[model samples]
Target: MSLDLDYLKLKIELFLLRKKAKKTFPEDLSNLTLWSQSTGLKVAVIDNDGFNLKTNLESIGVSVTVFYDYFKPVSQRQEKRKPYPFSQYDIILCDINDVASGNDGFGELQGVGAIEALRYNFPFKMIIAYTGNPAALSRRIKKEKSSNLVDKIYDKQWAPEDFMETFKESSKSFSNPEARWQFIRNRLTYLDAKEKEIDKIREAFVYSCLLKGNPKFLLRADAELENLTQSTLKFLQQGSMSDALRSGLSGLGLISDVFGIVAAIKGT
Candidate 1:
């Protein structure tokens, strides 16, 4: 019997290709109880002209509370702004340009001053900085030193529909802790499904090599298999509690792969 090495290699490669083409599961919020029709997201806007923005948000099932002006005059820009009904809002939108017009002690409180004050003082679940400025959002964030505090930034110039779509994509603006937990649970569930699929494919490939009576094939393929295993483990270990936890899971994956390889060979 001829050992068609080329055909075996082709089969392995095709199987590997399919195994590597992992499905990207987008974040699904449908499972969250907060997504119910009556439970519209509560949003707050700190913009000079937020009527239209509020309307846009409300059209998509958000309950908006607009604060016409963001920053007060020099004497009134308190270290801590009076807290609103915390239970009501999931997100706060601050227009940077609205901050540009505020006279806070030294001069007009520009973007940086406004961002610092809001980030430090405002207690909101999420803060999204928005402006009509032509500068890129990254540039604005860096300039204002609001990288840590600002969850997202939006360009008011973007088409209204595009703006809303991008907001939905980037912001996890959950209504409550339970809702956020549900979001994470959804991701973990999808990840678990992907890992099981990978395990089956890896087992089949190992068995195929063993059946060919090609002991050297295992040596040649081990590194590639290890890479795939590591990738899968890394995906599973996302949002892990610590580096130690991630390392532990990775070690477990290696052990499982070894056991799978041994089992495949023994079965053949």
Candidate 2:
């Protein structure tokens, strides 16, 4: 019927499915699997060599969204390159030497500037600087640490185990369900623009459904997803975000990737 009702229905269905998944899943499997898609700690690795490090992080249950070529999104349009973005990632591992491209207005210190910006944007989240050369931690880096602009400065060359250990020591607010549905809760969150709006709806659905699987809302999750997906919007942006959210829920294991109890009725 209405957009709001539509949205709620998708959420309720997703919630019910997760509950069902939990009950029927074998005991040997970690309950963490159900939560891994979204409700766990997520990380963003912004080194030129981030992918190399990404493999290590994933092994440790860290879902990493990496940025290289100056922390810009790979395969994305050039216009989306400016701000560099901070995903829903709980932790940030940034390399200082060559990534920011002066977006932060600091030439050699752009990474430090990014840290400042990230700290400002997410005051409560953990931001770690990948101090490539530990022997030469820069003056600006040290200053930020003293002032707490960054939670920690870690060397990339360190053993993976040691790095994560250091990462854990740097913040009290971070955690890993080791959980990947861990949606890594990959939300700032995955990338930008029209696509960004769409993803936000997607993330909100997964994040909310997993955390608040209340039955009361089940009556009208309709307000929440389905109608929102089909609603004739004056603006494309409004449509994309909600529709994208419905799509995201399906990816996370909703009853229908088609996204709604209404199902094929929309086409008819």
Candidate 3:
């Protein structure tokens, strides 16, 4: 009997391809709830003209509060120049150009000053620094170590998409139980027989990866995989190999080439 090595190779390649194509899930309320049980995040946006963007974000389930005139002079004091009570939000999104024009103490405000204020006043919150002036954003990232205070930076036109994408990526990392497992499975697919032994070594590496990064999702994934393995073994021990394989593959959404042969042999 000839082994279908070509079919196995294709199956492995496809698995690797799927792994590489896996997108980080967008962060949203569901993900936040999975981790923190928070209903909705409070966000404050400081901009001269992000009314539309704020509206869009609000439509998507964020509790958005806009402090619209970050460009008005401090001396103006005409409702627009008042300092925002920064304590109220989970995240702050600031327009760099607006910061420069608004705060006289910063004197033609730089992104660094905006970042510093957010960092000092709102140490627990995330900051997104956006600017229509690309030069200012770029200068902030390049010349100022203070830019680290901001979690992300984007141009005004792209801020909405970029912000959403950040949430998606974070959400995926937080909520997907199989992310690291899928990562390992993909790496396994590329190995030659000589490297197949590496799978034994991978458990430690995988555990290390989980430990070094976010602990919450890592623990959740580990618990999920453990339960899955236990259930699979129970099915196998009952001489229900076909049921075991089907359940395992279906649970993983995996289609191995050997599955066809197994199914054919089992008359299923």
Compare candidates 1 and 2 on TM-score and give the better one: 2
Task: Give Cα distance to truth, residue 54, candidate 1, Å.
Answer: 2.1
Alpha carbon lDDT of residue 218, candidate 1? 45
Number of backbone collisions per candidate = 0, 34, 7
- Candidate 2 has an lDDT of 0.49
Off by over 4 Å in 2: 1-39, 69-81, 102-105, 135-138, 141-146, 168-172, 175-268
Question: What's the CA error at residue 112 for candidate 1, in Å?
Answer: 3.7
For candidate 1, the 10 contiguous residues with the lowest summed lDDT are 24-33
After superposition, candidate 1 runs with Cα above 4 Å error: 1-39, 71-88, 100-111, 122-124, 134-137, 143-146, 171-268
lDDT over C-alpha atoms for residue 169 of model 3 = 56
Candidate 3, residues 104-156: lDDT per residue as tens digits? 66554454576666665443345777666767666656776544456666666
Provide the TM-score for each candidate, comma-separated: 0.44, 0.45, 0.44
Candidate 1 versus the native: TM-score?
Answer: 0.44
lDDT of 1 by residue, 1-268 (tens): 1568875875686465444333312123233222232135667777767657567767777788876665443545456443333334556777765444534542422554555555454322456777776365567557867455466678888898888787665444242223333333332232243445334433433333332234444444455455545655656555433442243334633333222332223211
Q: Which candidate number maximizes TM-score?
A: 2
Q: How far in Å is the alpha carbon of 229 misplaced in model 1? A: 38
Each model's lDDT: 0.48, 0.49, 0.45
Ten-residue stretch with the least lDDT total in model 3: 259-268
